[model samples]
Target: MSIFPLDHRPDSSQISEFFQEVRCAAMEFVFPPACMMCRSEMPHRIFRTAGCTLCDDCLGQLDSGHGNACRRCGAPVGPFTIATDHCILCHRENYAFDGVIRMGLYRDSLRVACLMAKNPSGSLMSRTLADLLVDTQYELFSERAFHAVVPVPEHWAKRLIRPHYAAETMARQISARLKVRLATGILAKARWTPKQAKSPPVQRRQQQKDAFHVVGAGVQGQSILLVDDILTTGATADAAARVLKRAGASRVVVAVVAVSPPRA
Candidate 1:
């Protein structure tokens, strides 16, 4: 004889109540799960605050700076070398952007946040990241120069699949924070390209060459800020800048969450 019979079942109402009780008990047992980065109780309003244990103190300690970086590209300089204002890459080529600035390196917590923002199911954390980016960009770039926010456009197919691009979301947030107009339809992708992550740098540049087109009203003499999640070789931004300049944008400045470290 079995101690518990398969046929023996509790009433639906009782079962529901029992599960609710169990859930409450489980939550109480894990009142504050550790943060993904610092393994401490996360602060309020954080996307994964419940699951993250990181406290305010730890979050405050995160490193965020260009660190004697390139004036144009914002790439960090080496410690031993005498700090030059611009990186070698920027010096080699003239870019459409008057300048660029980034909030933090593309590592650790920022990396996790970027991944979360890309997935459709990660909307909660993605929104948090967008808020952070907007706040940071407003604080960092307001003193410089920019009249509007232009998020790099996603190709039609990608937009159809994942309509919410983090850059566009961030642009909207930044626009509100700075009280500037958000002009999203100014740039359009002419063609859908393969993922840039796996493509070699040369191929990536070539892929974006004829990819973006400027549409709608021209920016004319206004300085525009192009927002994106990451800047690898600066090719994509370069392409976008070409289109914007052709459309009469006075200037184009690139702003991103991360810029890939120099190729080895």
Candidate 2:
């Protein structure tokens, strides 16, 4: 008699994925695989959970978070430093976000990669970098169970000059990988503000104040993953998270491709 059950029904998603694979195979001969970072031709591509297309050498140059990092700010710390409670650097600082996650410190080749993502032609770079962040921090990311992914919105004035907006690209790509919703409309920059880097320390907080406004009501009791290209002084992320939390978001976790080394 029959050893296999005949009642098994194929899932539609599986069928759709099968078709997608066939299309990818058909396109392979036309466009040979290449590393997204270095643009070197790759003999083969192994799509991991993050769907990365980076060559091994280039991937090695971009340091993943293997070293000890501060639990609060996600900044790399010395081996001898204790970060159980909070990093010594940011312990006294008050941040609106519950925690932070980063791929690595903003230095060396990783620094170069971050800058590349800001260019208008950096869509793939932005997506690949976002995938790298999730690939490096898979375990911690899974535990967060984020309800939505929100990019730190850019003011319209900046968009008029350069419209790439790497943060939004990263957030959209990351949200797809996590099988979660991308909530772009939840938060917005209410007005254009001066660059944080140029602002004085005393004026920095004031500049960020009233900068963001919550536009959607869906964030109530949600856990959000706030995406940004870099984190410096925690001011911008803090400003964004403050509004998210005020909108009834239960938690706001900052995710960045790089964390600028603590200001000297």
Candidate 3:
């Protein structure tokens, strides 16, 4: 009378075992027991320890504050007073976010890792760096309040060219840990512009002016953790925060994989 088998499904224990084996195999295949920062052979799991040899050294260096960092923008500053908490430009202007949190100083191994993460040919390294960024930022702001994860939007053209920027992946991982939803479309790029790495601070801000729009209804009265790969001028983050606030988000805090220290 019954077309279905009496014992068609596997027990929960069997399924769990199967998945565990598959996960182990996938991890070994993907990571290959190498130091994620330098690809050197790793004796132990870096993920469990927070970092391996190469990354550990770099993390230590980053904490030393060797860079001339602007207090307000988190840009590298040369000579400035922390009392103002404002770089020259920020002293004259305003930013939308409450503050910026960075994972490491951008240089040496950190710079190399960031480049790899941004490259289309560098998926494995990029994914690893993204995971690390998420973990580190979460650790730094363990006590901060956040309602959701929102990533800086790339232009549709750039998205088409580089389908997976590390920021989106990083935000998703952090959101998972925070058990909050990640909103991708809350802020969008309204213009296609050239890179801002070499642009002056004023130029950078001007270039991005009116370049973002908040889609649909506002995310009012909610705290947002805005994730990005790096913070250089703070222009991009500031622009995004402006739109997020305009759309009704209560507060915005930035989290970046790296902070390029200001040049002397």
- Among the numbered candidates, top TM-score falls to 2
lDDT of 1 by residue, 90-209 (tens): 787766666776766666667766776677765545555555555565655767667888998998788888857777876776667667789988889999888889888789889989
Residue 190, model 1: lDDT of: 96
- For residue 60, give model 2's deviation from the true position in Å: 1.0
**Positional deviation of 228 in candidate 2, in angstroms?**
1.1
Best by lDDT: 2
lDDT of each: 0.71, 0.83, 0.72
Kindly list the per-residue Cα lDDT of model 3 for residues 1-264, writing each as its tens digit.
Answer: 112356787678767876775676578667666554555665444244532334556445434554444445665556545553666656766789877766567887678878877877655655566566556556556767788899888998888988577778777766776787899977889999788878998899999888999888858888999988888878898888998898889988888878876567
Candidate 2 residue 259 C-alpha distance from true site, Å: 0.4
Better model by lDDT: candidate 1 vs candidate 2:
2
* Candidates ranked by TM-score: 2, 3, 1
Candidate 2 weakest lDDT stretch, 10 residues: 43-52
Instruction: Please estimate how well model 1 matches the true structure, expressed as its whole-model Cα lDDT.
Output: 0.71
Model 2 clash pairs are none
TM-score of 3: 0.76
Model 3 segments more than 4 A misplaced: 1-32, 44-72, 75-93, 121-124, 137-140
- Worst 10-residue lDDT window, candidate 1: 45-54
